[model samples]
Target: KKVSEFIGKTTNNVAEYTALLRGLELSKEFNADEIEIKCDSKLMVNQLKKKWKVKSPNLKPLYQKVRLLLSAYRKVNLIHVPRSIIKAADKLVNKAINSSLDKDVEVHFVEEETESTLF
Candidate 1:
């Protein structure tokens, strides 16, 4: 998040994007074989689904990455969740600078060899 500030990007929007990407990454780790993304940002939700075009250069790459990640999964969906229920993401977006959240990441896939249910 601090890096975004140094790069002259809106931390809120970047945090939102980071959260969305993290969700997609997690789905793959769970060996989900499918992915579903839920967000309160209508613009982001629609752009990833292609229901609307992304006119902002800032948002275009993120949208494209979501599409590519979706292809890696057997099935993927980008859906909207009402703001009332998306608490964690909201906090991430509205966090104060130098916040402790800098160490709290929701979706990371650095581990190797995930467990298999079939065993």
Candidate 2:
């Protein structure tokens, strides 16, 4: 399974958490009893596994949300892997970023043309 989204401007930590949240939502929708989440973010993996504390105030809310989502599953495990191991996910993220940038450039070009026509 693969998923990607443009979550706008956010730190790497927030983006990682957003991905986790979305995956949990999808799992619940499908009524999945067990889920193994693999990611390249070691910090997030550790935080969720309770191996490390979530010290950032900005991340506290996201950490709490993850905990809430985990309660819905009969079994869940978060594993950390090297970035090279998650090629598909990395490609998806790059595709989404490029897609959004292309749209932004198109919008800027159209706005410039519209302004020119107004003169």
Candidate 3:
């Protein structure tokens, strides 16, 4: 499954963190024991992996939430990939943004498939 949510006027880091949090939630709901998380945001990935410090006060709570959710899984791999590798997600984000702007309402898109991959 793929999901996109329109959160208004937030910084890029906050958006990245929010996406991770949502992904973790979905994984938990599905009772997934192991998951691989891939994102184009290096800062978010590194922060989660403990390679870099989360210096922004705005991200502290988000970081903590992500960490808390992640503990339920038996194994989790956080990988940072180039943005080009995630064009489908980028398109969803653009769609969400456009829908929110045009309709003046919050946009949330969820596409389900027989085989699911969280994004």
Highest TM-score among the candidates is held by which one? 3
C-alpha RMSD values across all candidates: 8.9, 15.7, 6.5
* Candidate 3 lDDT, 10-119, residue by residue in tens: 78889889878887887777888888776778788778878799999999999999988988877886666677766666776677565554222243323321222322
Tell me how candidate 1 scores on lDDT: 0.56
Greater TM-score among 2 and 3 belongs to 3
Score every model by TM-score. Answer: 0.65, 0.76, 0.79
| Residue-by-residue lDDT tens digits, candidate 2, 25-77 | 77776887777667788788778777799999989999999889887777776
Error of 3 at 99 (Å): 2.8
**Residue pairs with clashing backbones, model 3:** none
lDDT for residue 97 in candidate 2, whole number 0-100: 64
Cα-lDDT of candidate 3: 0.73
What ranking of all candidate models by TM-score puts the best one first? Answer: 3, 2, 1
Q: Whole-model Cα lDDT per candidate?
A: 0.56, 0.69, 0.73
Model 3 segments more than 4 A misplaced: 101-119
Which residue pairs in model 2 clash with each other? Answer: none
